[model samples]
Target: MQSSAKTIEQYLLELPEERKSVMNKLRNTILENLPNGFKEGIAYGMIGYVVPHSIYPSGYHCDPKIPLPFMSIASQKNFVALYHMGIYSKKELLDWFVSEYPKHCKTKLDMGKSCIRFKKMDDIPFELIAQLTQKVIVEDWISMYESALKR
Candidate 1:
């Protein structure tokens, strides 16, 4: 199903009290774990952390204004999801996960082209995931982006 269309704050504002608390906790965990140069904002109603297009205008195959977001966090009716596009585009990273996940993670990290879903904080692999966020460097990403723009 398509994600909702509210801003991150608006989406939280609209949730019922209990879900709000849950989302808040999940949001905080994500924020606290975020690495440097990744910006957090509302995109398509989820908590999106992106390397702005201005930083990587040509990294993605799209309009320059489009963002090259590394990750997105969203809370659904029954779960929360962490969308990491790097996992799909960078096979070395995904391979790392494949080899290490069973030992480091406790739950089945669902895959979509790149999304990782969790039903609760208890289902998440906090430390390793934090490492996942740090694996890609903004400097290198910017370099790659500039290289793409030159093509």
Candidate 2:
């Protein structure tokens, strides 16, 4: 999945036709709803965004520039994935999602402890996804990162 893309736009442009459409839609949705200081780009051969360590200096996950929180969109041969790091840091948010998600849909949200996997765009709850992204505000994430520097 090594992208030929030199930039995010190139990344989007490189995707196969159908995947391009879905990924672009999702990318737009996320950009529209994203809290300030968050940004979108490519990482690990996927379409994703990272909270840069330049802002946090110590990256919210510790190790500063070595590791940072990311939300990614993966277009595999079969399915698409909307993935994020926030699910691992906050229990309240996870609890809310677990309780609310199953109440509305019969199929499970194919998510792990942190990752959310979706085969199709229609399978995702746009509002829920938006809120989940919203939960980790930039200030909070930066605070967590900056605190790591103090330790």
lDDT of 2 at 1: 45
* Model 2 lDDT tens row, 12-83: 777788788777777877887888887666677777677776655555444445436667877766677777
Question: What are the Cα lDDT values of the candidates?
Answer: 0.70, 0.70
The estimated TM-scores of all candidates read 0.74, 0.78
Q: Which regions of candidate 2 deviate over 4 angstroms?
A: 1-4, 59-67, 103-106, 143-151
User: What TM-score would you give candidate 2 relative to the actual structure?
Assistant: 0.78
Candidate 1 global CA lDDT score: 0.70
Predicted structure with the largest TM-score when compared to the true one:
2
In candidate 1, list every pair of residues with a backbone clash.
none
| Stretches > 4 Å off in candidate 1 | 1-6, 16-22, 57-60, 143-151
State in Å the error of residue 105, model 2: 4.5
